[model samples]
Target chain A: MIERDVIVKGDAGVHARPAMMLVKEAMKYPCQVMLIKDDVEADCKSIMSVLGLAIVSGSRLIIRADGEGDAQAVNSIVSMIEHNFKPHEESAEKN
Target chain B: MANNRVQLKDFLGDTGIIDLQIRLVAGSTGITREIHVGDINRPGLTLAGFYDFFAYDRIQIFGLGETAYLHQLSEPEKKEVLEKFFSYDVLCCIFTHNEEPDSLFMEYADAKGVPIFITKKDTTKFTSSLVYLLNEAFAPSVTLHGTFVDVYGIGVLLMGKSGVGKSECALELVERGHRFIADDVVILKRIDESILMGSGAPMLKHHMEIRGLGIINVKDIFGIRSVRDRKRVELVVILEEWEQGKEYDRLGLEDQTHAILDIDVPSIMVPVRPGRNIPIIVETAALNQRLKKQGIFTARELDRNIRESLKRENKEE
Candidate 1:
């Protein structure tokens, strides 16, 4: 299992669109991922649970992942939040 | 999480479903005000000039007692009390017993953009109904990838991987005189600590996707008898692809449960193969679960009988 904390940088926080992006990003990896805010953990792959967290700007979130590629899953999710939920250049170019 | 708040307009719009029987009397523009709590307050003390521990965030209900108290106050006193009452941001105010608020209260409500509503129902009845409505709206809910069905009056939630035949099994169950609640995306709401209500997404209700047959409406094809809007999830059946050498349960001796939203529901694992009649198996599971609910454990009873007979034979020997 791997755990990392990342603060939301977007002014609007993690709203519906960002929540969807986070779920999409989490679906890329095979590991089970969870987003924890204020001790309440939500399944990262489930959009409803992620949205229910209601993460706000400047809120510290703990990204916990378990199973294969756990570290990569945590790293990618942290980077996604750090970048304000923008698509990565490499992936943007591929698209 | 902030989006968990239900707007005042939402409750008004859902009057048909919940039978609230409420109508806007003042502050129509404030209909969009959000309701943060599922509870309500009488505000009788607030009207009596007692503001300590005032629950202003909750929906305020003015029963006959409060309304009569307001009616007895002089004009100046009423204005003074109303000003102080509206000073704090009250989500909304409701008048039960079909009582109408005076012009001063309506003016204050309009000025503050606090929606005011009146219902013909009495205080206790209306309060209970509104609380029930708000509780349901604010309940913790999660969307799961599964199919929900009612088999022999038991709610059986079918879950597994994407291609694990959960939908097909539910479809067969529906054909066999059962009721289908949801398909693919099941929205589960924790009604209380122990009860979980399962329903389908608004747009995808009663619709199922078979491997090759495409999307079909279960309600339309199977008729109304085979469809239900929601049901209490009493059992969960997980269907998985049959592995080459996996050992399946031969006797139902041990009880199993699957947790959803922190509530543990009785669950069973069924391995699916081409020849297995999954629908009949699910039906039998539902019946067996009903039996368990009635405290009739068939397997345990048989084991107990065998032990008793063995004891008698050893004593005779």
Candidate 2:
């Protein structure tokens, strides 16, 4: 497994739309994915789970993946987060 | 490593800790000692025994019944038991049935810096809860990156450069019958040599934020089953914006890998393009990665076939 800590840079944080997007991305792998906040843990691929957290921008998150392609998965997720999840944006806006 | 501190509520239940006391026992060092009332053959003993043997970092004792008799025991008996307790490397004493330890025992415990806990629940329930807690607390764990999604019996992690729609893709995947692990950031720690465990940060616990929608709680929206604290990271899919001039791998002939700590993991780069179904692509990528792990590499197989054909032509020439 590989894990990385990332800051939620997007303006709204991980809200409904992005939560759904993240869940969709997580559904692609064959490994188990988990998101933890403090003592609370949630599934990374569920929109409801993402919503349950009510994560806001500037919150620190631990993006973690394990199994075969864990490193790549972690890297991709971290990159996407670093880029602020805006696939269409030319450059990520710093929050 | 220091043992993780458990919250008092977990051990003592919902009731607030009305009273807490620590005392140093004069004699014991390593041996475990316990005082409890009632039959020695109760069901609670089974659990108590487990704690005696497993729960503590050092010694453990299960004491039943009245504290008065124990305190009144003959000096020889007390010395013998205390000596035995002290002989070991660590010692712990448990008083069951809410039986308070004598003032002397409390003083001893305090002086020794030993942790003492008193619970109002029956021994059976307490023991059972303790067993459950111990197991959970000691379970092996690991940490990794990439949100873990369970889709069609596969664990997929959608990767990409920042703003490349990893979260969006994950949301879509969830709608398509997949589970969610985490978004934006994940925490991974190694609990054992082989296992890598993953989790989310405290503030981001059950939340995900999109570019436009703002923050959302995953647990509330998805229910208890939708969220998980940890999972093994399996596959990685890198999402990168499509560059018209840049050459992207059209075939799977070349292998790309990324390293986490000492482990080298397989990686796939998926270019982001309009009208592309990212979740589907990521799902396929996970499937492909699984197949490759099983030694079935489509790219390698094709390369071998091409090489074989070329060799056959050369022989004919």
Candidate 3:
């Protein structure tokens, strides 16, 4: 099993777009990926589960994976979170 | 997709649900054609030469009214409407109340290869039965090895391998004033693509076979309120034998699903062993599912509250 802790940096945090992008990225891997915010855990590949986490900005998220492709899936998710879910977003409003 | 098509002969003769002893009068060869629609139309307006909005895909019903209308029309006018109507690929026409079509109409039906059927049931009675049969016949379904029960108005399907005590748990739930839908085998049908409805096998309706207790009628023993004909499946509870050294969901914060017939349903796995109150757990889970439907997730809510408090503490520091 592989795990990493990263902080959400955007103002809106993991709402629809970021949650969907994370789910989409996680689905490409053949591993069971999960996101844990505080005590709440969510399946990384499920949009509903990720959205249910409601992990707002500055919240520490633990991305964990266990399976054949756990390392690759976990690395990508952690990297995405550390970058503030930025590449997919349309510029920053600097709030 | 079962919605594609079906044969006319099979629709009447094969389906035991319709219960109409209908006989074909004409267009016998068309029995092998397709029945694309899951509905039956009375063809009231279509008979009056208004083919603008004619539902040719549906099973057209020509009852006493249509039969009488044919008789009133002159031979040429009648033939024109029949020819115009039959020009389309009509699935099949049924005459209810034992009202057989006239010889002229039969000749036209035979020529067009559009099969005509006769049923003795009244229009109202036969229509309802036909609608139900068509709905059942076309509904996409799959048989599952599970026991279905209604706990607090939520359909909870208990799924597990053999000798897993699913029936015993269901029996306990029934004893706790819950309704029994099916035991041992559940036929789950997709109402649309999203909604799943489950019912027991006909021969085993309301009957559950326990390991040592043999077969028992849930309805007979528990009364009418204790058994239901069918219920909309909302949640699935999988009972597996308790396996030590395996990690289980302790927090209940993450959501899980069980896939059945391409639809993913919210599911939970409960490790079964001695001294565990499986029925109460199932009841609580069902109640939680209802609350979730009402836009409330208790665990998630608690997490949010805790996170906000911790943030406030950090701010104060």
**iRMSD for every model:** 7.5, 9.3, 17.6
DockQ of each: 0.08, 0.04, 0.01
Show the lowest summed lDDT stretch of 10 residues, model 3 chain B: B1-10
Give the least accurate 10-residue stretch of model 1 chain A, judged by summed lDDT.
Answer: A45-54
Q: Model 1 clash pairs?
A: A54-B1
Alpha-carbon error at B316 in model 2, in Å?
4.3
- Preferred candidate (TM-score higher): 1 or 3: 1
* Candidate 1 residue B73 C-alpha distance from true site, Å: 1.1
Clashing pairs in 3: none
lDDT of 2 by residue, B1-317 (tens): 11344432233323222222223333333223321221122213323222353323432434464344456667666555444433333334556666676655555555554545555555666555555444444544333334556655455556554468877887777766677777766655444454444556555675666667866666787777666665665556778899989988899888887554444456778888889998888778877877876889898899899999999999999
| Best-performing candidate as measured by TM-score | 1
Give the TM-score of each candidate.
0.78, 0.51, 0.59
- Could you tell me how far off, in angstroms, the CA of residue A22 lies in candidate 1 after the best superposition? 16
| Model 2 DockQ, alpha carbons vs. true complex | 0.04
lDDT of 1 by residue, B1-317 (tens): 21375788888745545878899989888888787778889999999999999999999999999999999999999999999999999889999999999999999999998999999999999888888777778888877778899999999999997668887898889888999998866888887899988887675667777767756889899999999998999999999999988988888899899999999999999999899999999999999999999999999999999999999999999
Provide the interface RMSD of candidate 3 in angstroms, 1 decimal place: 17.6
Candidate 3 residues A1-95, lDDT tens each?
99988888868888768876897889889888988876546667655456556688999989999998999999988888877776635334532
Going through the candidates in order, state the TM-score of chain A alone for each one. Answer: 0.90, 0.85, 0.88
Better of 1 and 2 by DockQ: 1
lDDT of 2 by residue, A1-95 (tens): 88888888868888767877777777777665666655456677655556666678998888888887778777777777777787745554433
Cα-based lDDT for every prediction: 0.87, 0.60, 0.83
